[model samples]
Target: MSRKKEVAGSPQRAVRGPAFGYIRVSTQSQGQTGISLEAQRGAIETFSQAMGYDLIEVLDDVASGMGPESFCSRRGLRSALEAANSNNAVVIVLAWDRLTRYSKFENQLRKIAFDPNRVVCIEEVELRQNGSKAAIHKYNEVMGQRISSGTKAALDRLRSNGVVLGNPSMKTSVQPLGAQAYSRKSTDLVRQIADMLMESDDPFSVPSSTVVIKLKERGIRTMQSKEWTASRLREPLKKARRLIEEREAPEPPPTFGMF
Candidate 1:
């Protein structure tokens, strides 16, 4: 299929209304496998053409499908949903699980139903504004649970076989110095700086010079064995503050059926 130029303004409409594609893959490796982003895009685009709808845009999210937060936190999915709501268009995916695999799928179903737009999962189900056929939605929910379970089992098998998952080691030459590279001494010093700043009335107003002095007094040197300059000290302190904030952030509200 020919790639059309993405327009800057409102999406061009068709006889059947605009169609927005939403695609996702859990990991970079999944993005390269058979059920890749490209495969999903092709399916959505082809389906849109066959159904007489103008394909407006394709949004992608590289995130796991295990939880509602995974879907909620995806910027791409948010944009797609907003566009769909604005245009009263249909959102297409390769399967229902691509949207979410939450144990209680009805919560997400209800959310999509709030708007007049439809959600079309090519392989498993189609949810319309009027609502999904109860039996069909239930079947899709069961299938999603099975898929999540199987994926977890496979990951467990890989772990048992000593195959490490997640991102590879950062190359120092290509990337900034990561926390892993810092010695315990430097890490503690950075944390001390972060804590002091956090305690201040205005964290941003806490000058970098104060951090430098603290590092010098603590006899801490960077991974490169250089004296702590304001610029050199910023990244570690930033990382430390981020870690603290993440630890202090409130947990997400529980999904439906948690009670």
Candidate 2:
């Protein structure tokens, strides 16, 4: 047989199967920072070609590493799961955490009802197979739960010490504003509004519409990559107290409210 024919005839040769790739960017900044959907697709395609697998599909979503508590909230992720389950193609991801942060993702996995044995997680290598899937998921669930609980406890302790939480650390990377930086801008605007409010004659006294208009004039914007409205303005304004005040202050008179 010819060398090509002989190589093709070898049963011991590696053969990649049909595969599906999934990518997610939690922040708009990630989308523009070049780890975008297209970039992910290209990487997955390269990986698939190198391994000789046929690239069948790509699934992605924009969601945070917070938790899968938002599993239902993400249409793209839901569709990705459905595609993976329905098709026998290998479901590939850049990382497991891209699926969700540890805590609630295991619960979501369990609820998904796919055959545990048929599942495989591949990073630089295949991490697990279907038979080990359930056990691995359980382990992840336990770890995530423990971490989440520990985080809550830590935050509570910090609160008791009067330390601020969720406020960004100065060491973190600064994100830009607008469609490319939704959460960052929204957070900044809320903080600014909060400062204005808590220092006002009455924090709750300002109309939401008025606050939004004021915010726009000052170049404030929403996290959803859009302008704020009266009702929408009310939400972030309400959240301002939570973000600005780590814990509730003792009730002073509703007026004279510099607690």
Candidate 3:
């Protein structure tokens, strides 16, 4: 009878509800600079506010991937996930990298679908342009390639210049760019080029000459239709904002070397 009662009772499980958000920054600098914990919270709050999600808890971890194990693998993160699973709470996050920077592990998380949607990685995946499904995928792929190649080239150039890169302790020495080094117009052009390049998935990957010709045939400009040239399309990115117009916020100034 006891055994039967045990079988009949089973384990009573209470339905869970969405209640927590999880955020993480890989390195101390990333936590402080590029992807600050505060920035993560702000972004999450903005997203939640717009989407109407009841965010009741936040789990923030400041851990770097020194090896294979991720910050998500920590006990605190594990406990948070368990609680969310039991409560069926949606775990809101700012970007997939914030939760798990490693692509492979992030993929694993995607595979293990949790009830109440375990995580929400905002700004991690680029949305396809409104159009045919096939076209959107193709466009995104191309853009991603261009951006990646451009970034790689920029990093390589920096390395060649012998500038110290990375955190202070583990940094390699290199020269630093000085103030008043670049002209305003030049800076603007650099910025435009960088924007175009960053938006592109591969710096080397671009529409073929024929495609460019066709676009020109259709009266479309190759970035600068006023004076179209292959060189124009391949220039480095830089910014040209007026010094006076630049925001003078003292609290959170953008610093270099975060990358």
Candidate 4:
């Protein structure tokens, strides 16, 4: 196999170093859709090739960009940062948000791991070291403030409009203002599961494995069209049991001695 050689007289070829690529998507759906992992990898590869950098490795994650905890918990990000720091290599990302949504976290990462001269984002941003530092700093400040205020405003609007924003099980949307949309099949499955749990001596304490076995016997598959694992059935079963208990709980008697 013939190894590709760098073309002569290319500016990028003249400026070369080891480059570590990092990519991320907030959800599985995002990983499957446009700007997917594959797309990000391609972009990174192209940039690395053009810059004549030895592409060390591409690290990735399917995680939210909400906060520092989210970024810290990502195994790939940790490994990538460690590798880049140890190798004294540049870290490349497709965009700024791919690195972090939080500006504070981004700044901290730059101070600790990312060298402004080495870290490169494919997107045309003012933060590039080659750009005017003073101008970029002012621009970044204004843009960061705007983005933060905008996000806060959006969240406030959602809260005011009664939209559930977090975990699916914990989410409850009001009608008229918001819709509590559940598929018919899912509703029926949950109800059946609830009934099965209610038959146990203590529904809340019932093992998820037992529920999974029952579900399997019934030939019922999850919304994802897969056999239920213990973890998969846990939350739905718990919610079902809660609903059943609420329905079965007795009402208090009306007081008749009021003067």
Model 3 agreement with the true structure over 1-259: per-residue lDDT tens digits = 0000011333333424355666666666765543355555555544544444555666667676433476356544555576677777777665555565455664554554554245665553454122123332443455466568778999999999998777774323322332234454456554544444344455334454533454356464533336445555343311212221243324554765566
Q: Going through the candidates in order, what is the number of backbone clashes in each?
A: 0, 3, 25, 0
Return the TM-score for candidate 3, rounded to 2 decimals. 0.38
| TM-score per candidate, chains pooled | 0.41, 0.39, 0.38, 0.41
Ranking by lDDT, best first?
4, 1, 2, 3
For 8-86, candidate 1 gives per-residue lDDT tens digits of 5533445577878888888878765524566566566655654556778888888788876775777777788888888
- If both were scored by lDDT, which would come out higher, candidate 1 or candidate 4? 4
Looking at candidate 4, what is the lDDT of residue 86? Answer: 92
lDDT tens digits by residue: candidate 4, 1-259? 0122333554545557776888888898876553456556666666666556777788888888887677677777777787888998887787778877876776667656565556677665444333233323443555466568779999999999999787665435344223324456677778889888878888888888888998899898887889999888877887798788888898766865563
Model 2 TM-score, 2 decimals: 0.39
Greater-TM-score candidate between 3 and 4: 4
Error of 4 at 68 (Å): 2.2
Per lDDT, the best of the predicted structures is 4
**Cα shift from native, residue 124, model 1 (Å):** 4.9
TM-score, cand. 1: 0.41
Model 2 bad stretches (over 4 Å): 1-15, 32-34, 115-122, 126-259
Candidate with top TM-score is 4
Candidate 4 structure, TM-score to reference: 0.41
Q: Summing lDDT over every window of 10 consecutive residues in candidate 1, give the lowest-scoring window.
A: 127-136
Report, for every candidate in turn, its global Cα lDDT versus the true structure: 0.68, 0.61, 0.50, 0.71
